[model samples]
Target: MSAYLQAKVVRSRGLCVLSSIGKSVLNRDLWLVTVGDATVPYYPDPESPSTAYPKPKFAYIGGMHGDEIGNVQLLLQFLEEVCTAPREARLQALVDSTVLYIVPCMNPDGYVQLTRLNANYKDLNRNAYSSAFPYARPTTRDATIRNGYGTPLHPEAAWFLTAGGAAMEPETVAVTSWLAAVRPTVSADLHGGALVASYALDACDSKGSINDCPSVEAPLPNLLANAYSMNHKGMRVQLDDTYGDGDFVNGTTEGASWYTALGTLQDWAHHVQHLHMITLEVHSDKQPFGRQLAVLYSLNRDSLLRLAEMAHLGLKARVVDAVSRAPLLAHVELLEPKGMWPPEVEADGLIWKVAVPNMRYSGTLTPVDPGNPDARYPPISFNFTLAASWDEVVSGTGLQGLSAVYTMRARQARRK
Candidate 1:
């Protein structure tokens, strides 16, 4: 770890000390870095009328295959910015509530070689699904369309597969294991040389839902993906394809299939540990550095902000519960409300006031099950009992707390 991530060699941006996981086959120490609060209380209050919210966790893994360089730079840049930036309201809020873990380089030996496969020539992503103890690395690239070349014997693969899955490569095992312990809410493995934000959920497969794993929940997989797309849709500075909006597929193949590579990082984090894992392909092989950097910043800015906002809002219910006499960790979804106001009166300085809707339109509430890792909270139907109106909060024993607020422009006000 020291040899590869020497402090002197790395530019001082978001420079956190790297912990030694172990050594590579080529005799290099594997390393990892953890950022944000580790210990925090997380529980739902049943008596409360809303959901209990805790800080969200985000993990960014880069340089896994070695040749994917853009993501490594992006992680470095993010680390620097996060470290130097003052603990303003947003930053502190995210830190206090959310955990951000970044693995800048996964396969250091392979990274030095600048090859898609690690030093052992094994494609790390392919052989990650074995369940047996001290998993074996696949010696063959016959799995997916020969995406890349390499055997499991590659020192990097052997370290993780033969050693204990991710543990085979000391750095990868340490980081992956730590993630399992922390159970981050979201994580993404950064990849390059691809243009789409490929989501490998089990879609159109005869092998019985291969994409449905313990890590990614049903609605959330789509919800988070859509949110990312929506955030980047209109940004003027963003490039055409940098935001990762594209069709969804189970894997990089035409058919869906079940996989069980015991030591795979993404699958381990999601299935074994239950974190929302997304593989983000950051740049194409032909993309230039400057343009790639622009794309990275755009993604970091919007995606991180959205994650923070959702985490913050999720915390709101718990905060409300603390103040109220009754527990408020009930099923509640806050929707932005919209309403039409009567003609506004301009008096003293001719400033106009538009009436805004205090309550949000009612939507279904899903009851969360704490014990079930793969289970999605069932949506509570509310439309049958009440008309969809802008004024009422629309609460029930079934729906608990569903509220929203909407702000309309003054120019759109109607006449009495």
Candidate 2:
């Protein structure tokens, strides 16, 4: 796989760049393949206009479960397509408009062993810290999960308060850290064992049976799920009428309604980072074999690309301190908690939110500085009317007419 990735770099003519997010439990390299123009800085300088290549970013992660081998292959093919596609193609526009981050193998140890858990025998999905569950963020980190089930005893906790939480695995740390750095506005976590796109707002019965929960944040998980399912001919239909959780509404299910999962990547990405991530169960009963790879690619190619484009369909804003003009990590939201999609500005001071087109949405941006309270900024409110089509306009910032990026200056002083 490493050689294939390197070959792509050579064949891509600077289109594909490879780097390591971190190591696996057994010290295997967690390879991160970035497919886009490498010359542009991820976050362009606000003061300098020419270098401001601000656009939405889309991320795809596969191979969370070791036995789900096809997940990794699917993303590999997607990367290859991106590298080989014509410069004038829609894929090129995706690359030009947004920075793409792909991590084909989030669990190399599991893939090598062909097991669902990592070398340490842990589910990487369950290893992440979730905002949905109110477990304390551990002060002193360790690799031991307090609850072997990877769930909370209380079952319903708000955000973590105390400095005591479960220990985490290395794979979880690596993926979470990488996700924080990338800060994808829209992403998809590929999986196997089923054939439907799953959104969030979850719950599992006592018998561990999954249900059909709807999104509190409507059109978020739903829109992306529909985007993927409607594009994939195979995803929208069910060969077996009675599947695990029965037929999803057009091949889409709410995360909670599917089952009660603890510390899920889907919940963590949305609740904590405001990233619109969906769990795509790519295959039917089990993982498909070599012969089915091409079919899987064919079914998912357009669906996945649609997700990349969806990243740019909503509001995009970059907020900074009004005084120093330096970037500030502020919390930006477009709706209430149910329809809510609030993304905190990355180090780049940018938030590209995914949303339904042609709607009027308003939200508030509150700057945070837990480390230094004096540096905190007041909340700033915004109102916007989205275009009927792919209307993501960048208002203000002396950059009207061009609806790609917006700069918001928060009136506050940086603590000396």
Candidate 3:
């Protein structure tokens, strides 16, 4: 796998990057292939979410369930396709606007054993913890809010989240730690064993609705699920052979609504990382076979690209001190959210959240470090009209009449 990724780096003339995020349970390298820019790409370090990324960082991760090999194969194929695509191709444009981070397999131990659980018999999918369930205190994420997350909804939930939290597997630790550094704007956790796109990972709603989306930020997450389902050839039309995972409204379901998942990577990305994450179950069988695999790849081709495209459509801005002009860590939230805002994104003042295109979204920015200790600094409120395309952000085409001085570039207002 390392050889293939490294070879692609050479093939693409420095457009591709191959790096190991961390080691797996069996000490196998958890490799990540970054597809973008001819200039050697800058990898983000922890606590550095700066304008180093003028474009959105998007990731497609697969193989949480070692048995779900199709997801792994599909992502590998995607990397090949994009790397070989012509410089002027649509794939290049998509790459131009978004930094594509593709991790072909997250659980090599499970994959080698052809099992759902890792070598330790723990399900990697059930090993992620969300920091913002009962929600979190915006001022400091010194600790995860544990009000309602300590209990197990089912026996499977105990694999990770419970009264006695299990130790995180190496693969789980590798993923969580890597995410902190990359700080992707969007992510798709690809899976098999079913055929549908699911989002809003909370297992239940605030009003006790089972498997419903339980975030104040449901609209954008739902849009992510819809983008995959609507784009797939039969995700919305064909029902899965066994699990009945498909043929839903628009081929998308609220995750945990279709079925409950505890400590999944998607939920952690959404709640803890303040990212718009969705799970894509692209096949009916856990292990796909035969020529149908090619057909399946064809099914998700457009959705894969469109998902990255959506990242560019949302709220893209940066928060900085008016005096020192330094980036200020801030929590960006919708103005009239139905519930508490998702956890604060640890970025270098730059924030990009999925939003409805052509619609007006009122939002607020609460700085983590107010410049003046003597004076009171209240959350600054602002509004903007989202564009239908990513051109606004990619070209640094200037602002959308923003009230706050948020230049959507690495140096923020340098383009101004």
Best candidate according to lDDT: 2
Off by over 4 Å in 2: 38-53, 85-88, 129-166, 203-216, 239-246, 318-343, 346-351, 363-381, 389-416
TM-scores for candidates 1 onward, in order: 0.54, 0.74, 0.75
Ordered list by lDDT, greatest first: 2, 3, 1
- Worst lDDT 10-window in candidate 3: 396-405
Write one digit per residue (lDDT tens) for candidate 1, span 6-59.
452244343344565555557665555555544453323354323423434566
Query: 260-337 in candidate 3: lDDT tens per residue?
Result: 566677777776776778898888778876787788789887778777666555655665556555556666676644
Candidate 3, residue 44: Cα displacement in angstroms equals 21
- TM-score of predicted model 3? 0.75
> What is the C-alpha local distance difference test score of candidate 3?
0.66
Candidate 2: residue 295 lDDT (0-100): 88
Candidate 3 residue 341 C-alpha distance from true site, Å: 3.5
Better of 1 and 3 by TM-score: 3
